[model samples]
Target: MNYFLMLSNSHADGVLSWYQTLRLEGRMCDVVLEAEGVKFPAHRTLLACSSDYFWSMFQDYTLESGAHTISLPALSSKGLEQILDFIYTSWIALSPSTLEVTLQAACYLQVTPAVDLCIEYISESIALDNCCFFANIAAHYGLSKAFTVSNSFIARSMCRILVAEQYKAELLELNLDSLQEVLAAEEMPGVKEMALLQLALDWLEYNPQSALQSNALLCRIRYSLVPPDELSRLSAIEPALCTPFIHSVVHKALNYHLQGPLQPLLQSVHTSLRTTNSKILLVGGGPEADRPQNQILAYEPRTRKFRPLSTTLPTKLQHQGVCVVGHFLFVLGGEVVKVDEESEKSAVMTVTDQVWRYDPRFDQWEEMEPLLQKRAQFTCCVVEGVIFAIGGRGQRGEPALSSVEKYTMNAGCWRSGVSLPHPVHGQACATEGTGIYISGGIYGNSPDSSKDVLFLHAFEGDAWQRRASMSIARFGHQMATVRGRIYAFLGMYEPFCDIEYYNPEQDLWTHLKPLLNDRFCYGLMATGGRRVLVFGGRKWQEGQEVCTTNVLEYDTEYDAWREVCKLPGPLCGTQCAIMTIQDPPET
Candidate 1:
């Protein structure tokens, strides 16, 4: 009986084999596809399931009745043959010679899976020689990721591309928007600004009519980021840029030249996008559940949106300390509570030293040496390329800890550092110059034991010393640094609208403008040099408090706050940190 059952199951697994056989033999085909006046046999049900265009055609009974065969007018014969083979076999051949045509056919049929496969192929097949060819196809099919990936290849091989006679000859046909986007990218980190100017001039020489007509494209160039010397060279080459009206822009850029924090001259939409856009990462703090399934979330500043990263922490974590060391993002010690099987409810589980490091450049993660002591509700900071994890209680949340540990990238080990002056947790920490600053934390055993005392630890001194306290007590608050100044945010206590910072120079804490809403325990990150973004947190209203997805962005230079974007759900008491990932590798 078992032998017969095995035979039946094996046959069931190969049930689709009949479709492949029929497609290969051109026998019992219910539909015919005509491309370039040639016919190919296909099974209607298989084609309908594989392609939206075919599905819609089959859905209309009147259309099916009128036509026994359909003409794929936009598809080449080879492309149509490949599509039919994919519908039956779940695979199709792709190569440089046929990749573009195959992708075009798949997109026209709205076959997302095949199109995705084609995109993956394009991403893998990118090289300096064919990057523009791939980019042209990507733009035609609205494949933004493909364009971005290929552009990096083009950017890295830029010197070669600039000199390549083939690319120069084809520059005239390059899409205008694609050229603008590639040139506008602030991603050109160390490639001297002069090279970008040269590329722009090269394009202008080939297409002067468009250059003379469109200043909007010209505005996309990051003129402010360039040095005055480079601009001088540019002016010598392009006289239109130095004309009286445009020369004023050059003067503004050269004078300010993005030298100081107050250098706010360049407000062009292009520069704003290039400079301000970065990804803010969020971890844990999902729906409260028995099992505690938590994943990492990323917020793209360019899109002003939230998206979850593909990888998650080793286990569900809450109140974990996160810090960045160079290209690596480290998730330090945190607490995880799961329901006991006997009680069937949440229970005190464990304080974890489980450490996970993520490298966003490669979208990869690995386990790092765990912390010396398990902790949560702690504050972490990176000073002089070393990570310091300080003061937080163990599981069950009793007597607070004064322990501090340092994680060094070179050593890849955690060693004890000078502990905090006293037991405290839920403090906010940031590094300004060479010192690490801690402000506002809970001193007692519980969350309610909040305090406003502040402290500073200089790696030079290797000691923690008491500093001036905040005007109000806060616990579970956040801190962010902008232009060497530390900004402390309100925690879960009263005066939730106020934000204050300690002045290392004056040794005093001062309040900035109060927030638009009272918030506590939201994910906070500083980006774009002048802006601090706060994510979802709890909100108070009608004498009741509940979790909220509200987000507010504050500008330090302007001393102004405005709504940006919201998280996917309400979150509170969650830990957050900001780190910049290096751009794409030299292709």
Candidate 2:
């Protein structure tokens, strides 16, 4: 019988240390590695053990196996010296200035540990000045982690890198593939597509040798989004862009503007807005006691400016359910107020079952199949590509509806769905993942709003399950899901400023910071991360209801609210959605 004994990992480390000392002292060395007229003496067996390149070369079958010296002209002497030190001591020093040569030597010698070490250093050491260079090198060597980190850094810092005079040379250093990757990214914060187009054109001008790639580079631009005015300016100045390909592209964009209401039907890559171009759209709202405004206003948070789109709704609608599906905006059952022609000046508000779909691609609105039941003040949500219209009031005298209806694009028709536990109207509804949630609305014929919350696992079943109730009863309010949690904003009349959020996992509701001012019939929209925006609405002031233009933004992360900006006009009974539309020409 024999006992097995283990010498700890320190023994191996000691052996490496002893070998390193022997090589440094030029003791018992077997081979000499040379680069750039510099020679390094080392043990052949130790070099073979450390690198696959040396291991194969030292084999008996190889010409270098019998030789006492090996030449590595492709590698820098400094890089080889550093790599050899790491092989002996299990440590290496890397700096931005020498990273390229070091990584090159590691890759050339098939020293994977050193290669990974070099990659890690480059990833952590990326800076504005060297990020583009790192991206190029990592891309060249197919070093995925370094490539991804460097490209992400470049994209995030592009806004500064593009405008700063100091960074221009560095930006210009990006190769064709790297430049294309940077330009095509949608995460460039404030860098608009036009700016990217200008950058691409500048890159081409700077690198005249890349002129043959003009079409490939320029086509990444969403030409239709470049404002026809800018296109005209570019056409006049850039003789290089006057090619037939660019000319036709410009023509198509101008024609898109000409199409006006027909833009949706002619959707294309050139006409599609980047996700970064998404704006908060205030839909179908107007001054109190006035006809609902048909002209949808787009509110740009970055600029804090509002612009009304050229395309107006087919009808002025209020209390409508709005949802966006795959770039298409659907307006469901709503109250359409029109002037009573027989009564001369009086307005008649009629509940409509008509549905309309707005296609931003062409700025066109098309009437779709009517809802199964005529309802207003209902809530609609999309899940699994199907649209579900929930409880609402039907007509003027009819009681609030407990019935539900769903519409599918495949069927192209509305069908009945599972009824609500109780008829409710003026409720706030929102969806997260595959879950549909409705909370805080008046139940049937009751003047008081209910704090009850109901949920349905959409696509899984028709049953509605009761969840945690909200802190306050709300009506005509809005609900939005942000960061996987549902938030309820202020509604009408009672509990003027209370706001709350729900956590589905815990089935609980917690009060959040209330609004600075009390308002109702407003548009509530959630965008980006943990921020909810409240658009135009009506507020009670001096004993009279007055329309307000105030826009409030809530920061869930900080549990606070602040007035960011104001809407274009005082309006209420409106809905808002974040939409990617063509960018207007810059002033």
Candidate 3:
């Protein structure tokens, strides 16, 4: 009896023929054998050989049953033959798509090569999808090119996707403008509400203007679509959503939509009086003074004009601490020197602890109670009518002091408060809430400086904590707060014109636009609203000293700096103070 066996076409026919001969020659064949055009001799002597062979046969049956035959890409006769050979002989070079299919098949069959090919092909085509899926995959694989491509597509399509997808937090990684656009374009009724609520809470946390703008846009859309009664109901559901957008909308609604003569515009005369107009207070030495007594020049906001404040001091002053409380300006300790008649250079002079108060109403100066400790290069901040003096140099600039004292206007006396943890001079101080943040200043003498930024909490009781450090290690830089961000500008370091902005919440520092000229010991004062006035500091050019009369105003809203007015006279380190004066009520 002749028998035949089915095996892969790549197997040698001679080898299988030898096996068949060996099985037939036995007294009883231990293998099942069949030949071409012949049936198996089952009745004569039938035997199952190896279990491995039986399992292999079973897998072939399973694959045939489960195989999904999809149309393959059209190929030449040779290519088709090669593909068939690969299936029958298990040897064929694969294309990208074919490799994906082979990989899927291999995974089903527990084949390693096929699985590897699939991963390779998917990696190469990472930029193929709309980026939502591929971006996630790229992030997993740590493929930078894939990430770049996917990020680009996700940013472009972010607006069109439903807000539900955005809530997944994966979309938060997108740029703020893209998120705003998506929130703005969403037209579904509840979508705007959800978007606004999420964005408003995010704004409260992140407080980016873009997020706030998104909240405003959603509020507008909600008002337009929902009825008045429904609007009230929705706000009741989410009170937080209403509060963030309300401040902006209330002002707009009151000015544009309300009727009747505007009720005489109850112009916040006192608040306005409390607000300072944008003006430059030029502080420097006047040419006529017997000594270099500190003097101030003022610039008008509306007319772009300059006026000299009638107030004058004893001599040319440097490193004075100035703070404004209501309409009264307090000028604290500063160093004064007299020019030597023989040498024509400034010589020994007195460093005074004299606290001088200047009233804008009288245009005069009055000597107040002297500070308990005479210090120069100190920083001052006014909170709740109490002036807090922090960090300065002691008499003769020998001992740097870390002492802090509070001057209460009610008692008309100076009292010791909490001292800073470390010594600092020429520090930038700004008040926020109940806390005062003091940033980058010089601690030790010349050639040895400190770049550390510290935050002192007097309300918390005598503890000074570290906050974010400035980008550049600098001293004699002017610090001011605008819209809740701390700005440090024009220090005496190598790059004298740089400006650094610190965000207290994020504990991060970002560089702002540089100054037009180098400035040292410059004056920086907030003008309320959106403007900050920066004035008089000494500038250097080719070993020659030029006292700067240049006045520059910074607009936070526009992110711009512009030259407002030039001082009439040379002013450097004059006792500089700023006060907001409201025009008197009309009769």
Candidate 4:
């Protein structure tokens, strides 16, 4: 019986002849068997087989049955000859059109050497005209060298052909240097020079330092394209690049090109900003009031001011789980109280599990489902639109909770996550890029706080790791990141004048000037540009705690603090959220 199979041209690269001779001599009979009519079966035992037979057999096998089958496609005589040649000699050369199909077949057959040779040939043959399509395929298959070469070729050619006047700005999206090289090569006598200048100016506006080192190169090209007078006129372009150039003029800037650290604390803040920068809705209590009067305050960073936000809560609340996502602020469980008029009696306040959302657009609040477990003194942060409620002491005299629950913004549902490594209350939680940093809170049974900084990285991924400890212990302290540095503000502990800064990159902490007023549990918000605003918190004096309504602002640039605005009323346990907006002050 004779068996015939179709082969791809790519398999014609010369290993098949030896295998064919062995099969014909019946030396490989144990591994090579005859199937009915024009097809030979590979005896599952033969380690080596002709590429053509392998490709055909590969396409023919069904993984479902876990067995090999002889299946061949109908082919012209020429195609059949190529198949036989590859089966006998292990290699076949063919046209580009035929090569593409064979390449796919070779890959399917697990023929490594043949597939690689075809890819190399394609890469060498790629040109500007066919690069786009070829590059797409190369990128999809993770053929790095092929993709880069094809893209570079197209970019280089585009630069050479398109004149300054005819240059397509969309081409800038390709490769910057290649585009610049192309522009440099073209000789434009008229409006072409002006167009090139305009394109360069726009690029410099968006990214100044990107091409900083290449300024001399750009200047030389400019001199060639335009007269000195015209080049000088283009100097006053917006989004000035002159400053950066001057800053690096003295010395060549270090080209370390180092990537920023994947800090958990830093990632948390970035994640929050990307998810939403809507109106910050603050929830807290009024001074000395039972049935804490919950109020929402909104601040626009652009204007650098605050405005009261309207809410629809049936009663006031304080010490609530507050988190902002998109345009909505989710305010969870808090405490409130009732007063008796007939007997002038006061009672222990009642805790609530009510949840409310504040919409900035309408300045309105809507009621939502309450928490399954009521918590106060809890901290909440949003990660990937999911609000995580962490360690907060429950109702009065209730045990502190290590239970971590996550509220999904998309599903409008709450689910439990990996509990905290340690339960602590009055902790300051800050999110940087993708990680959450939970710093200094009351950890053990004792009220004595911890200086240990607990770092939870990629909290959504169930990975938690601790980092270096803080220089000082703090609870009810506020933490904010400005200029890539973390500032841990005043909080309760032995040191009454506690204020510290943490540098995650260095894994070191430095002490900053203490707050003008020593206080703990203040509403801290980073606002305007680089200002850290401290609202209200309790002040401890002579073993007594007093709530203060003073508002102080810390300038990160100057590393100094100055009192800004005072609260309308004395407040404690109030939420303060700040959002940045656009619009510069009138000069």
Candidate 5:
């Protein structure tokens, strides 16, 4: 049997303590390590056992193998002394002022314990004040953990660092790779992509030789988030951004802005927002009382909570056609209700041709070119980069208008398109692929709603082609395209909870699971894939029509409906859109 002997931890510590005492007393020293005129007398065996640098140097057939003294000109005296103390005592004192020099000496001497201690101290002590300095040293020494921590710190503080004058020098001092890493992060609050673009351009202007890295730096910008007008202006003046590579990137972004209805599906690195928190924006609407409100609420789906946005509509609008082109919200052709000052319950509804575009980037609204005709209760759908406003009521008590107007973004004008098969209002519109489909609505001079469906493919300057009609006629209903199929939900003039989907390929209509309760005039949108979310709407209860706050989700795959939650309050005639908003910084 082999005999094994091992000393206890306390006994082992005692031996190291004895060696340290001997070194401190300047007795039995075998080598003198000198740096910057400062000398440390230590045992060769102890240094060789503690550091790989000393171990390899003191080995046989080496330059310093038989030497009694070694000079290290690359290290500082104070840093060398601190490292030597840790090798024997197993403790090191580190401060922000001395951390750089100390870390350099430990890394140069291959003292792993001291290096690890210095990194740990840096990781815990990182702050906005010294983060850039720490990042520079960490990158030079190839310290991955330290580099990552310090780099992330700079990115998270970018909003403050960019605006504060004190950090201008530090920001300009960042290396190319470090600056790219900071700009690539999306966690910066209160900082927009346009500002980031300017920062990159400013850096390029300051460091003219860095033009070679212009493409790499510019690619970090989410150009889709920038306004098209501003992007066009910048491209004209900034020569560096006009390079072939950057030009192609910018072209892709400009095209993405015109996608409209298809923007959600065409998301890319350039188009995707820099925010992780996306909220559903519920635009202007009214209650069952027919009084439209101007409040806009942002609903967070993850938390199932609602918060009002700081920006609201310029004026109260109802039955408006809402659509998002790029990051802008367009509210067009709605009835502006003016409540009577004396008669609290009475109000006058005036049809307006005014068009308002809301830019979330600046939280400001601009009056765009108004519609060609004043209308309300119309349905708007974007196809092939054009917004088509379909049939609606022109004047207050007039018959439904069959005229259609097309708004081309590039032209900034609304032109007449082919008329509908017949004048209809309260129709639900949806875009399937590149085709625009309008479902059941009230026809001209007809007391009852019709189930007739109309289709216009590619907007070929042709008349509406009649498609398969729904099983039941729907008016004031909602229609959405999910998983490439058109789904029509229950609406007014129809008390049934029946839900159905239209198959264009088959030219057929099939009934799916019916809703638990009948709803109409509700805010409906396709979250993604085969799922659809429905917000507040008016429902019939106890022989009376009332507004409901119930929020329901429909899953086409399961053919089922369930109440997910409730809106902040009962809202009808509202428009809901999914938007990416920056999350508030953590306290």
Candidate 6:
């Protein structure tokens, strides 16, 4: 093979690069542009060669109509100058500050190259921080490709994105229709009606003049997720709820969500949330040592490979709380340093208030505001955009803590939530429907005691309420939500892979098929909403504890467990989560 890179293109490059010089010299000039208040001279051939839109315009105004002035009124003189400069240079300086104006002019003139380049830049720039603003721009200019890219990013990172200072301004200025569409978009994870209601209330605070136009937006919220206390508190003051029709609809939905309705009036309301795409994430807990492994591995389901990421936690973080909000993984507080096996000094295992977030798009870990209190060995899950950190070991290696706190992704803040009925440590938590289910945790005792209890609760209003318990007693298990069902996979040293399912409607737990062998403390998660991926942890072999490097996959639809890939190295006391990495749309 021969490579002739950039060879003999010198002559062509010279002519194309000097288009501006010739135009300024008035060489073979055929037209003049009176755009806004400034005048620009150009040759018909030069303009035609640069853009099809320009060629079409020139064709209509024949050469016989020589020296004619084309009246360009849509853009300012500066906007037109940027376009002309790009035609000559094949480049433009695009920044967050200048992108919008240039895009407007390019779209107005139907410049395909300019428009496509701008769209590509926007797609590349889409992140949790700027997704909302870019989505609004994409929607306004009818850039469907950009819209899809930005909208999906916004939908996935809705809670985190909303808390951004930039998004606050963008949301207030957004057209009512666009704002409503954002609230109503499908495929949003960990977002409940209460969060949406909070968003709506925030919008009203910013744009109070639009209170009259909010009923249409309010109707889309799932009112049943809002607890009766909060609903009653806000109804007396919130304008949208004050409206008769909207208030009645909300009250009606609230009743249906709280009570058992024989037949429901609302058919379109989504009682269940949109299922998120999944990729397996293996978090903390590796080999025990003074120097520990902070490697966080993510399984690329599409590629069928396990890859270690640089976005590991700030600490060794064993027995930490991990959950997925959109594609971002939030790891709650855990033990910062390792504890000595023989010493058993409580000072060796220091707990931290740190909360970290791993963003797949950026491939980076960011430390958010710390928790209300330092904790370790806690159970956590995202319930409609809130990270609920349930019972765990308190500071100074104390017994299980019944106190719970949740981080609100919407506001970038953490506040106290209702505490669990009993203390819990090393429990498994998962979300289905409107509630978070706690299963098989050891509360204030060793792993053998009270480890098989289960409780279901949600943010009904302000307080925590308990539901029915599971039949089997399990502790030190992993939880994953698969197709709206909560599946519990338990054991590591005592090595048992028996799985169980919790039915919210029937309020019962059913045991599923057992695994190939006994496994314990493994990192278990549901990927692609159909397959359960069990990652590495230790298992007992002939009275010897050894790490299991092999991974297992459980196909829910087929009801089978098969041995899958093996980790490069085995890890124990590790945590795991599922994050769907979004690839940019094909051109």
TM-score of each: 0.53, 0.58, 0.50, 0.49, 0.77, 0.51
Q: Which candidate order results from sorting by TM-score in descending order?
A: 5, 2, 1, 6, 3, 4
Poorest lDDT segment (10 consecutive residues) of candidate 2: 259-268
List residue ranges in candidate 5 displaced over 4 A. 1-52, 68-71, 77-95, 111-126, 144-149, 162-177, 180-187, 192-279, 286-288, 300-307, 493-496, 540-551, 560-569, 579-587
Clashes of each: 0, 2, 11, 32, 0, 13
lDDT of each: 0.71, 0.83, 0.56, 0.57, 0.84, 0.70
**Candidate 5 residue lDDT tens string, 1-587:** 99989768798678789889999899999899999998999999989988899999999989898888999999999999988888888989999888988898899889998999988998999876788888888888888898888878887777777777777567777777778888888677667788889888988988888989999999999898888888999999999889999999888888877764455456566765566776788888877657889988888777778888888898988888988766567889889988987886888888999998876655768888889999899999888668889999977779999999988876778899889978999989999877989988889989889889999875664878889999998888889888778899988847668989998899899999898787887898888667898989888889988988888889999998888888878898788877676654433
Cα RMSD of predicted structure 2: 10.6
Which is the winner by TM-score between candidate 3 and candidate 5? 5
Candidates 3 and 5: which is better by lDDT?
5
TM-score of predicted structure 6: 0.51
Looking at model 2, the pairs that clash are 263-362, 264-362
Clash pairs, candidate 5, are none
What tens-digit string does per-residue lDDT give for candidate 6 at 1-587? 99877767687668876777788787766788777879888877877777776777777566534546887887777777777777777787787777787788787777778888889989998776567778778888888898878766766666665556776556566556566766677666555457678788788778888877778778767665566677778887887687888789767766654432111222233443434445577787675322336887767766677767645566776667787774567888887776566774533567888888765533557778888888887888777667788888876547788888877654577888887777888677777766777776776756463435445456684554454565556667777778877777764334446677877777667889887677776777776469888777767678876778888889887879887777878776777776664332221
- Model 2: lDDT equals 0.83
Better of 1 and 5 by TM-score: 5
Residues forming the 10-long window of minimal summed lDDT in candidate 3:
42-51
Error of 4 at 9 (Å): 92
Ordered by lDDT, highest first, the candidates read: 5, 2, 1, 6, 4, 3
Stretches of candidate 4 exceeding 4 Å from the true structure? 1-281, 289-291, 299-307, 339-347, 540-545, 579-587
Model 1 misses residue 104 by how many Å? 28
Question: Candidate 1: which stretches are off by over 4 Å?
Answer: 1-277, 288-293, 340-347, 444-457, 580-587
lDDT score, candidate 3: 0.56
Expressed as tens digits, the lDDT of each residue in 180-249 for candidate 3 is: 4434342221122333335434543454545446454344332322233444555566544456556454
Better of 2 and 5 by lDDT: 5
Ten-residue stretch with the least lDDT total in model 4: 255-264
Highest TM-score scorer:
5
lDDT of 2 by residue, 208-247 (tens): 9989988877767777767678877897798666888987
